[model samples]
Target: MNNLASQEQIIATAILIVIYMAVVLWLVIRGARKTTNIGEYALGTIGFSPVAVGLALAASMTSAATFIINPGFIALYGFSGFLSFGIVMPIAIYFSLIVITKGFRKYGSSVKALTMAQWIGKMFNSQRYAIFFAFLSLLLITFIVLICVGITQVLSNALNADPFWVLLAVVVFVFGYMMFGGANSLVYTNAIQASIMLVVAIVLLSSGLEYFEGGVDGFIAKLASIDPALVKPTNPDSLLFRDYFEIIFCQLVIGVAIVCQPHIMTKSLLLKKDEDVNKYLVVSIIALTFFFLVVFVGLYVRVYFPDLKVGGQVLPMDSLVSAYVVSKFSVYVSLIVIIGLISAGLSTLEGLIQSISSTITADLLDPLLGKELKLDIDSNQILTNKIVIVLLAAISFGLSYQQLVSPNLSVGIFAQNGVYAYFSAAFVPVIFGTFLKKTSLKAVSIASVTAIVVHFSVYYGKFMPYMKEEVNNPAIAATMAILISVVVGGIIHQLEFSKANNKEALNVH
Candidate 1:
């Protein structure tokens, strides 16, 4: 796809990247100065404006998958991809985020919960449950790998450099700075990244306007001329968006549960005042509506590369957006898009590193070592958190390198399998714990285990008809898991409640 950039473009990109890195480092240093303990590191002591935190939430929620990887899917599958990723998913996610955030933050702040695992543990009065989730949070490293691969693809193509070296440099620089900044720097950096991404989203979305010259029908006609399936709302040739169930139902369910991730849901805790929640949600929903629509650029890129090849080489799915950027835009404009792409990845990357490392250090290690072994982890938690980030960086690099060299379909699939499972298990617990006045820990725990089992089993075993394909859809597996777990959890909760009520009646009589 003529992915290599011109020497002039490469030099300009490198220079701008250096300036960006310097600015980010300066902000990290500024934030690190105020971060004296784990509490400040996880949920900053500073009272940031709701607008900034809202921007951060939008950026963190819209990962590289939105900007770089998922568009590749849209390019391959066409309008059906847009219907699922751009439309249905965003609507469900916004609704779920609005429903869950305020209640979670109210309890989280009241309990001084530092991580999602800690929040769940405290809500159910079960440290063991929190520990289990802390370990499960390791699965988010797959998501980190997805972001790293995304940034690597953008940078490597722009610089005409080796992907391995680019990946290494990205992981080191990001993870190294993240060792200090935590939430304090994360909010500001993410806000800046979000602003850049918002501009790029507009540019990419508008880039396809010329295709709409003959009107919306003309655009559909153009796609239909290439491949009739491209214009269809449901593409039979595609694995992920083959029917109403996959395109709408599965995506809707996934979108609702997707916010259960630590990096996403815990973002509300960044706000100090209750009054700020509505403003924060309003800004986030508005910005994210634009960010998710950027996937439409895939259809534009597809129209540009009808054969899905350039220079007689078939373009890889993960590299579609990168190839399009370098080919479609002038050198200067390409550099700006490249910066925004990097921001899209870095915003979510920073949040994952901060949240997961905090989960490991605060939720997992502190409970085991400090309480059980009587170790002084409390005094050295900051140091311990840095160590955890280093470990996570190493793991992310190994897995990302594998995906870069040889992926099943795209790293998006690999990420979805892991991330979807984690959140599917979390969905019941987070929902029941937040809204229900009296929740049975046993019921939630059973539901969580059921979710994990069902997700992996269905994914690996190909239990459902939708999963019979070689590259199965993780969303389908996740949806089944979420539904089954909710049913199982609900029944158990009712049984427990009824038994307790009966006991109270007998005692009163």
Candidate 2:
């Protein structure tokens, strides 16, 4: 668990990283040329293959959480973490992704929407609601903070650099490049990142093949040897995996709602044609399944670092995977793995910057201040988008530095709180908008507001049974919000329909 890399290893990794960044910058510059305005930047005008966008979706959806931080959870909690993260969560997410993508994409393409906030506004004929959600897109800054922290951890471990400098460098470089490329550069970079990630995922998943010396039972036995609870489906002493409610139910609800994010849901809109969607989905699902299973590497790392100490320092959960990688692999192999890890963060960071900046420029700032500012939003939107990215980078750097210095448990919790609240509020709108033909703005907006209230209440007020303790789970709060929102939204929609029917009948009579 040594955190320090050798001088040779550091130099080799630094050189390789420079070469990779050069190639990526070239792609960004090329894509930036085609991106003249916000529409083209938001959704690429250049025709891309479904397979590529599909891979990009997989890459963006599976962020640093999947590759780096979440593994730390598994390393600490064992089988229960695996069950929630690897099994139940994936089942719920994949099911939700398959269900929503088709309809969301179909509707999104028809509306010609640029952002998720725009999609919700257009669907319900409510610009005010769009503004609310656009401001809420600020919640995604927490996620940006998560990815920045994660990449900082990986790069810091590889080069034995200070986390502060690494964090600043990461934000400047990723967000700086992202200002120009938007979706066009993002998809190409993501596709390439996804390809490397697929290979890395396979390598990491198979790294512990020798652990399967006997069979499935043998793996369990080894885990049991370390700690009996490590093999259990639910670890009683753990913070998050205490019961079925937390492990299965909470994950199920969050999984269903997780795809409502602008970066993920709008990924399907990148494809120019409908016929390409099936192939896009097919490739993405397969690739993402592979990405999700890579969480198993967490369990492997836990076994690798049984004591969870590096240089006699108790390794923080966020730093465990990076320390393991730096210590486990040789210089050459670790160099490649380091690139894959950085790719994991950059791929998603790029998407979030693109989507959220567009949301700020188009959905929030444009509608609110365009006329007053006398900005020709349609003609010179790209400049506004660049401004948005700069603001995001500054805010993210400040928040991420804070989290890096003092975290609640991990930056993962900080991210989940903000990100979960967002998708929770968004779930009802996206669900009702995509599935129901007859729905009112009043119904959806009320439900959305209710979700926002409930999510915060459950988390901060400690209303849920689980939230009464320290290190409370954000999933519980988000799940409750999504559940309540759906019920409220459905009832309101039905009431609105019934009232309309009565009015029509009375008029006809």
Candidate 3:
């Protein structure tokens, strides 16, 4: 694979990346000028068009997992991976996004909520609940690690450099800019990144048109020739997509819950006007639909490397997309794809850094140190946020290096485990808080705790049959956790409601 990228190609890619970084830094500086207080830093002071925020949402939602990592799953597991990731998950995500965005934004903007923890805490009127979620937001670091590993793979392959150095460079550069840029810079940078990704998605999807020259059946037959299971909707031999339960049910449940994450759900609050909400949803969903389909490129790469080998060495799933870009495209084309891939990772990385660091500073530290200790936390919060980003960068680099060096199948697994648990715990609280007129704080709190416990117990303890395997599906554990939490929370809410009604009736009599 190293031989596939010429010396000229490497130099061209390196130069393009440098110019790309410069453009991003310029955007950050422009945005930072508007970011004076923690509020502006978190939500941005500038008014952005619905279309731009929509693009930012699309870019953040479709991270490197869409462009770089998940394709590796499709490459390995075949049609089953497409069914689960490409088809099932997107359907659930878009539906959930549309359903939740309106109500969330209405409440978020009204209260001037800055982070998920702040929203949840205000919703429940419980400072402890907010602090709990603040701690849980730390789980998002796993997702940051994922984006770092993905960008590292693309950059390392494009420049023919050591992945360790690439990973280190990616973390420092992206996290450094995010320390000051916050949401102000993130939206503009993400909109630009999303535009590049849109073109690159089309380029990548159409790159293997020759495979479809004989139509859909011919493409299936080509894959079947490689392995009959490649054409099947369910790959029993695979670790993640073994049956309808894993492919359809689990992914469907996880998809709806996935939008509960802070970076995704809070995007609506960026829109200032009620009229903008509908347009934001429409544009983002349409763009994300196309971006999600980019995973189909994995099948093309599968056909390219039938045995999943290049230059007599087996290609790791994470490197499959990078290898394909360099080997299959011209130098110029490869550089475009490389930049798009980096954008995919950076767009999401910026969001995570902004949202998570804000959670630490505003939701976690300010509450604990300021209110609790009567300190002037707000006076130096922006500086504290920058320090939080630095700490996050260090943690992300360490975890990302581990994934790059020794992954269990792919970094996707490690990420899904932590991310799934988070949104799983968040699902009931977010859903009930958004739609229900009245909710029991105790009930929602119990539900959240149940989700965390159930998710890890099923995942680590191997309680479910799906978990009995050597490599478990985080979706399965997450789905079970979600189901149980919903049931528990529902029961508790009803019981409390009935008891309160009885008390009111007695008082009236």
Candidate 4:
């Protein structure tokens, strides 16, 4: 594979990444000095501004999933798929701003919530529920790390570089910043990254429109020419409209899992004031609206590069919509695209690694295994977090190498499916419990556990049978699992409330 980029483009991309790395590192280092305890490091000593929090939240929520996979879908499913999934983002922003702001502020700093599981446990008064939720949270973070690694590898391939080295470089850069800055630094960096992403996405879309023969309409015609189904709202040959609708609903609910995500919620605890939440909401929503255009670029790419192949799958690189421009445009423009996408990936992974490390240290190890290790919770937790970051980076680095050696063996399905299953079970019950004061801890616990177990069982079982030549989209399976969790969690929560009320009445009599 040719490097296919000019020296000027390469130098510019390198300079941009270096500047980004330095800025993020400086922020983290500044924050690190203020972190005296586990709470401060993991949750930010004082609250961050809502603008910062919101931007970080949006960036973390998008991740390589948006950068890489969404484009892949656009290549195959066409613009309709982009619209279907893309629509939920605005809804997510609205919920965060209108529905969630007041609730989050009222909850405030008292909770010291580092993970979504902790938030759920606090709301429901059940550590068992927290533990189950933590497991799911763990799975989600794992998938994120896997995706980060996957995208870095893909980027490396596109650059004609060694995939392992790219993974190693990214892991170290992210881990270093995250370990130094903690939550506060992560949010600050994310805000900057979000800005870069918005600018870059806009530039790519504009340039692409100018360069393409048909613009969006012309591109659509090309797609329809190849396969008429490309323009259809849904492809009956592949996915049904009912399935697509269900997928939309499921993704929307799963989107709530973002509210409960450890990395994103940690920003809530870091809020400098309640007002910051408002600012963060506005900034995040506005930025995300622009970023959504990135998906449109993917759809645009499908029109021209209909025959490109990735991983034995005949698919266009929808995820790298900007990269298509690189093949056509001057090196400087392509450099901008690379810089933006790389920033998106790096800033996101930085938050993810730190958040996961904090979870392992604070939520998992210190609580469960610290005493046996003969160390106090606070000091030991810090040490453990650092160690976990290094180990995680190494593991990710090794995995990237393995992926390059045997691309087929390195399919990212396991991580994605596992996360979907975990979040569906973990977040649905907790969010529902938050609004229902009467929702019992016991019911929450049962529902939470059942969601985890049932999701895993069906996921690995006959529900999405592996025996099929063309497997059902993991997105569809995930949506089904989330729906089941919502139904079951709601029922269990109601049942527990009724039983508790009856018991109280009998005791009073």
Candidate 5:
């Protein structure tokens, strides 16, 4: 209810934040020296170790959603949210990550593909498809907005400052440095961020050990005392997790396909050699598993505020974790967590800004304006990418400010809508290209189109109205999109195979 941070806490926080920024900026400028071209900027010229890249990968994949927003969901809806967010989703994602990363990196490095749109285009041999996806990648701006709001919430609460000023300062600082550092600085910074996250995750998870005085049984009893639904696998009153279908099936589908996003899948391309893949996957999966399970911290927060009230105001889900951190911890502990929280945000925010800007400059603008503008890929393109980042920062700031002012249920929904759709379209091309041979680009293309259509149609149309309210869940749309893409892509792949077989047989005759 009160501004829990003391004057001393605020001063220490500001000092620590400034020191962190200075370190980051120094590292970034050092990396920027080698980035004479767009290629070097996006892919990084640095010969990074697998462990460093692994930590970076973990940081990129988790984002503010895992550390900040989803925990709020668990705090609100109870065990159903935890079962889905903390348990089932991680299993599905880890399995998918291991299965997909090696093949993707191998092919990506072989072709020297620097971004996801470029990879898809190269794999399908369709420049048009690549350009289309480059434009589609703009949808990731929603995710950037989500991170901006999440970080601002934490910083504003900790500093007891106005959210608007915090939001402005965060955007300028993050996006400004990102334009110079690119991927080279990003991996190093992300590794540091991941290390901090690993520590804070342990602290947050352990903070509630006292509540577990009765052990696992006792913890559940505490939740049950407040609301019996809090202990159940499904919370009927909740919007997202109403049944087995929504909780397990939809979450599993989303987890498996979620990595198809550019910032996530392209992380493996940072590693240099083939032999390092196993080590990278091992470290990343292990670290990310802990990060994912940290959503259970929501349970502790819920127990701390059983009524979910502060000063008689029902806390919004986006701000709940920020509120809880300030109220629960002493100044010293809270300062550490605040830095870690900022890291959680910056790691992914950096990835999004870099990948999206590079995709626009390299994949979209280069193709559209290169010949007409008489531009070269070496120096001119790098300048274009910076310009792109500037535009991206402006757009992100506006959207983020809007969400912070009047959110439609939370910025997470606004993000999931756009982010989910982009990845759903990508799943077919990436999956088929990596594993299956003799795949038809036509088939993959059509399947992608189908996926995007099906996803939006399901969400907007409210296709199935069973045990349900309005179709506000993004996972449901994404799940349906993935299933149909796989099924449709398989059918098309078979058709193309037979057609080729017939043509080859005729040629032999």
Candidate 6:
């Protein structure tokens, strides 16, 4: 499609983007002042108020995946795709509150635990498992960076600007703020950016009403005229139905993985009190629910510009940000689009970088070099973390560029697939095990390994005859993975206990 942004809109958007970035940078730096040590920098020392933690958790997890890709998926699948918000949000909140209640309270305020791997290591008494989890966390972070880069390019297209330069600019700004302050910086900035994005969403949705020339019910009628199924609760005959359900179910299971997600876990850990968890859960669900509604505005674009094409390719289904902004409002909406996406990308990235750096230093490098290198724990840990942060960002930047420029692969799709795979394989075990007293460490091990094996099977076994043409959905795979983890984890734990009881009896005899 031809560029929708007028010069005036482009200019306004550029100014807004600059201002937004400045605000975010300020939040990052200001928060850093309170961060004298690793704990403060990594998890905010005291846990946040429940409201703040809730918003931060909801915002951090709602990346480009939810904003850009989901609406598009909805366009294809209608209500089925949107149902995930309802299913996953409550489950995630419930799981987090239960798992984190004790863990967060027991850990010292100044302990500076940055990653879930550290916490999990303590719980299971297994460094090997922790390292394995640490790597999976790193992989998820990589995909997150890629999504950031991709969204930058999309925002540029919406603004009629050079995609390469825009992506670079966003990367530099995000990296700088994250490097300076870490997770504290990420949360503070996310709160600010999230607020603005909400306002912008309201503006776009309000403006789109003019095009609808109808009230809410009228608009629904119009939408039905285009595709009746667009408003339905299900897609009955779609080949994708089973797959989509799998995605939603798995998403719910893996959503609990947010508890184990290093970046998000640290945010929860940083809060000031256990009471904050409940407040945060409520606030986060409300805010994210509103945000999801705003994104669905894209489906309305289909009603306005049904045949719009960009580069002879029908605007990709994932082009919700562009389609909604371009078709519903004036090009000035690009300002909101860019700011919202940047907000989403940077908040998550800041947390990811902070957590990853701490993991490498505390878990890997420091243990090896601490005594021999004669480095002091506190000062050297900070220095090592900073260095690792820079290196991780540098590597992620390269991978991001490759995905952006790749011939056929879209960064958004690649990330969604990879994240679901990683979460299913790694986190499903930890979250469930936390609540189930019957769950043994060995059972957790079985679940984790099984998930990894199944995940890899879907990817590599694509060439196998039975698997070929199976059209693997990461969501489906993740759901199956978690189920296996839960069932196997429970069974294994029980069997082990049974064996121990038998041994005790035999010894008495």
Task: Point out the worst 10-residue segment of candidate 5 by lDDT.
Answer: 463-472
What tens digits encode model 3's per-residue C-alpha lDDT throughout 139-162? 999999899999998988888898
* lDDT of predicted model 1: 0.94
| Candidate 1 local lDDT, 1-509, one digit each (tens) | 25468889889999999999999999999999999888889999799999999999999999899999999999999999999999999999999999999899999989989899999999999999999999999999999999999999999989988999999999999999999999999999999999999999998998889999999999989988999998899998998999999999999999999999999988998898999999999999999999999999999998999988989998889999999998788998898899999999999999999999999998888888866633355448888899899999999999999999999989999999999999999999999999987899999999999999999999999988788888999999999999999999999999999999999999999
Per-candidate RMSD vs. true structure? Answer: 1.2, 1.2, 1.2, 3.3, 1.3, 3.6
Ranking by lDDT: 1, 3, 5, 2, 4, 6
Q: After best superposition, candidate 2 residue 98: deviation in angstroms?
A: 1.6
Q: For candidate 1, give the lDDT of residue 29.
A: 99
lDDT of 5 by residue, 1-509 (tens): 24756787778889889999899999999899888888888999999999999999899889899999999989988999999999998899999999999889989999999899999999999989999999889999999999999999998888888899999999999999988999889999999999999999999999899997888999999999999998999988888888999899999999889989999898899888889999999999989988998899999999998998888788878988888888899988998999888899899999999999999988998888988645584778877888899999999999999999888788998899999999999999999999999799988999899999998888888886741454378898888988998899999999999999999999999
Question: Can you give the TM-score per candidate against the true fold?
Answer: 0.98, 0.98, 0.98, 0.88, 0.98, 0.86
Query: Which regions of candidate 2 deviate over 4 angstroms?
Result: 377-379
Tens digits of per-residue lDDT, candidate 2, 44-130, equal: 888899999999999999989999999999998998998899889888888898899999998999999999999999998889999
Q: Backbone collision count in every prediction?
A: 0, 0, 0, 12, 0, 16
- Candidate 2 has what TM-score? 0.98
lDDT of 4 by residue, 1-509 (tens): 43545666656666766776677678878778887666777777755666767777667766665655565555566656665657764575357445654665456356766666667767777776666665555575555555665456446634656656676677676766566677656667777777777777788567656435756577667778867877776665544122455336655755655455566555656676676666776777777776665666665566556665433444323224434654656767666667677767766677667767766666666657768954475666677778878877777666545544544322345455666666566556546654566766665566656666666666556455331323344445555666666677778777777888899999999
Badly placed stretches (over 4 Å) of model 6 are 85-112, 204-221, 224-244, 256-259, 308-313, 331-334, 368-375, 407-410, 438-440, 463-471, 503-509
Candidate 6, position 286, lDDT: 74
lDDT score, candidate 5, position 219: 95
* Candidate 6 residue lDDT tens string, 1-509: 34666777777877887777677767767777776656556666444556666667666766665566555666565555556544554466456545654554355233444567776666676777767776666667656555665476566666676666666676666666666676666666667656765676576556556645677677778767777776666665332333445435556665665455566556666566666666766776677766656546555565665553654556655554555564456555566666776666655666666777777766666555668644465666667677777677677777776666661224555565566666665564556445555446687777888877776666556633223433444545555666776677668878987988899999999
CA lDDT of each prediction against the hidden true structure = 0.94, 0.90, 0.92, 0.62, 0.90, 0.62
Better of 3 and 4 by lDDT: 3
Q: Pick the candidate with the highest lDDT.
A: 1
lDDT head-to-head 1 vs 4, winner: 1
